[model samples]
Target: MNDDGHPTAWERGVLERLLRDTLIEQRRARRWRIFSRLLTVILVLAVLGLLSTDVTVPQVTSRHTALVQLNGIIAPGTDADADLVIESLRAAYDNTHVAGVVLRIDSPGGSPVQAGRINDEIQRLRKLHPNVPLHAVIDDICASGGYYVAVAAERIYADKASVVGSIGVLMNGFGFVEALDKLGVERRLLTAGAHKGFLDPFSPQHPEDVAHARALLASIHGQFIEVVKQGRGERLKDDPRLFSGLVWTGAQGIELGLVDALGDADSVAREVFKADKLVDYTVQPAYFEKLIRSAGGEAASALVKSLSTTLRWR
Candidate 1:
């Protein structure tokens, strides 16, 4: 159309460029479709995997020591929570070929209620399966409520260096009255009950509230002492410092009658139970939950590493 009926050079060049652009665009579209389909398949598989993580009892053909790990803080919603431990203990007892059971504990302890629940469940399971003896193996530190859970076991083992015992209850918190004053912050609290605002951090510490708190702690401590005495019986020594919130090394614990002997989970499985092969009966969290928790822990670690930034921001 450029003054002649023949095809012009410029018009031919333009056609070639347009055709190349269209081809490239088509290639891109095809790649994107493939990527979308791949993503969809991955998402479906992940969903299925997460949904199928429920615990199921498996028949064992050989005798083994069933291991149920109690790690981290003994709080609700944690790995060492009562529910998971109870389920693991039940599962360990349910399996027919289990020669013995081991509750491996590595915790500084938290939530006395959670620990008590686990202790009670352990006792119940042991009573039902008396033949399958269960032993508590302390890994690193097992104090406070951790000992509460361990006391229920038929026998407790630990490494020579492992920390054991803190048979006491504590309800600790900060008194921020001075901090609020420095920040020019006013605390306005309302409650229907007379002691509803007990141990309020922003208010001045009341002698009555302090006395009440001490009494509550003493009651829980007394309960803890009773449980220990019932479980340990004559194994525990008559020393007053035994239940004074003082931790002792496993070797020292044996001397104090807090630990049975110096041995790890492996030794207990091999020597005490005579079963070298160990089977894990601990109920694990779902994959998705684990990922989420791992991510949260990493974020928390990062935040802690940037302590100055966190303080400044607040």
Candidate 2:
């Protein structure tokens, strides 16, 4: 509508420009959506690739040494726990190509129950695969529960300075009765059974409870002594101090017949297995499993701290 009342060329040109810009914007948005979808697909593929790699079993050779690491605390939810160690042992033993298995241990020891489970599994696996001799190569320390696990091995090797042996059981706790008395606090604990709160730190110490605890520790210690005797057999020295909860250096361990040889994993792999190639067969927990376990562990630790008074292995 120039001067008359119809339409203006300038207005129509402006409208066309606006329409073109709208079309461009729409195209850009569509392109962005496609790019985002492609990126998501690539990320998913990468995650799948990583998971597959983790799940893949290593190829073994007849001349290769299979390694199962027992590092860190040997307790439930730990790397050297019974479940993981046992699983690794099974994998190493099951592989027909593996000539020998080595349990590389570097632990300060933990739960007796977990250690016992691992020791039993090792014995079972040894019986099943007698030819594939399993050996324990101690690192810095192999004491208490760690030694318990090592005894199951056909031979135990250690460095000259490696600390070995702590052949005993103990249950440690702090007495809070004095502290409570100082604070004028009286612990009002009610139990259905006479021995239900026998070992409570806040309560008065009972002679009968002390005796019971000692008896329990003695029983576990006897079991540990029996295991060592069975595994080492004639190789173990007939010394009373060997099982007196004393730690000895690897050199001393050999003298006491606690260790078979003074060697490391590499030496054992080369000389004993006759193979320099070592393949790890340790079963590591998945990321998700670890996350879940960590959360659960916090809750469990709190519960145990609140309830359990005794019955723990150093």
Candidate 3:
């Protein structure tokens, strides 16, 4: 009877150990399932909330300085993109309680086209919202396309040591001609237009293309100068180097008439605009984006945006 029916002590111990491990694993799996369910519910609720939420210009009860910040490179997809900036500006302008609009600028400049659109919008908004004055306050730097946008404001203010001007237009591209030749690589770009492929980096540089590019740059430069002249009018000094694509400190800019005075946002709001209360009117991303961003999907969003080509104006 003992040989046929009795179980070994080691075998029973092994069975108990296996039972414990299995229970532990089951508990772990249960916890994971519960966590996943809770996470899913929370996400669904969040989605519902976002769907119900409206993205609109917030109304202010009191007269305050509406701060529209041009914070980064003014390109198509950036925060300082013309579309976003113009949206912010339009909201600021439309606000009944907005005493004055302050465009807080800090950039090394980006797309000239984007900047020009923003500048033009500012001018148009000025005419529409004549009661509310607009002023540009330079923080760290406002150069090139940044300055172009700034000029649209009625008055430009900056800190004494702040960088103020680069009033220039530039198109930058890399040249791989020498590297291609060294690597024995042949350039094979076919274009329908005669001059379409002239700027191809892998191809040999031609004098005619160089001359044409310079001419194009000069024409854009002339447009930039005309804008500055119109904006500054009699305030600008009679210095030939003013539009020579040279950056200047705010103090130097004041002397050259690039910046009107030395002041910060606080000073501009309190002393200049006479409104101590500052209200930010920057166009921010919707709640869905912020939620996705918090849950580590910002890279996914950026990747989706990067499917299109990007052209930079340096």
Candidate 4:
């Protein structure tokens, strides 16, 4: 309505500009929609590809050294748990193209139960696949439960300076009775059995409980010694201090008959297996799986910490 009830030129220009901007916005939205659809498609394809293939290692047709890594605490929920390690071992032994299986151990040791399970599985697999020998290659430190599992291998190899060997059991806890007394605090614990709270850290030390614990530890230690003897056989030297929960360097390990030789995975793979190429068979958990496992592990640790005032072979 510039002068006579008709639209002005400026108003028309403004309307045209608004329409142009609207069209441009619509184009941008459409482009973003297309990009989003493409991204979704790509994600779906990637997930399907992972689901179709082995979750552990890529399939190889050529003969190579099959590698399984045990690179953490050997607890139930840890990466070096018996289930995962044993599963990888099974796959490696089942693979006909695998020249030899290598257990790349870089752990400071953990639960005895988990270690024992892995050790048992390795021995069973060894007997089943007599041709494919399994070897343990220590990276940094393999002590306590780590060495227990390593002894099951056909041969143990380590670097000259790698820390190895801690062949003993331990149960660690803090006695808070003195602190409680000093603070004038009393622990009110109730149990059905007389010896139910025998090893409670907040309670006074009981001689009978201590004796029982020592006996139990000795029993487990004897079992550990038997397994070591069985695995190393004549290679292990008859030393009284060998099972005294002492850690030794890799060179010392070789001298004390704790380690078979001083060699790394690369040299062993090249000379022993004659296959320079190595194929990993360790199971890598998915993102969600890892999240769930982490949560569960945290819960378990809290529970164990609260309740485990007794012995542990760590």
Tell me how far the alpha carbon of residue 277 in candidate 3 is from the true structure, in angstroms, after superposition. Answer: 0.5
Q: What is the lDDT of residue 279 in candidate 4?
A: 88
Please provide TM-scores, in order, for all candidate models, with all chains considered together: 0.78, 0.79, 0.76, 0.79
Which pairs clash in the backbone of model 4?
Answer: none
- Structure candidate 2, residue pairs in collision: 1-6, 1-7, 1-8
lDDT of 3 at 37: 100
**Model 2: residues >4 Å from true position, as ranges?**
1-55, 289-308
lDDT of 3 at 286: 53
What residue runs in model 4 are displaced by over 4 Å at the alpha carbon? 1-54, 289-310
Name the lDDT value of residue 132 in candidate 1.
Answer: 91
Error of 1 at 34 (Å): 22
- Please say which candidate is ahead in TM-score: 1 or 3: 1
Positional deviation of residue 282's Cα in model 1 after best superposition, in angstroms: 0.9
Model 2 scores what on Cα lDDT?
Answer: 0.87
Candidate 3's residue-wise lDDT over 76-107, tens digit each? 55567687888899888877988899999999
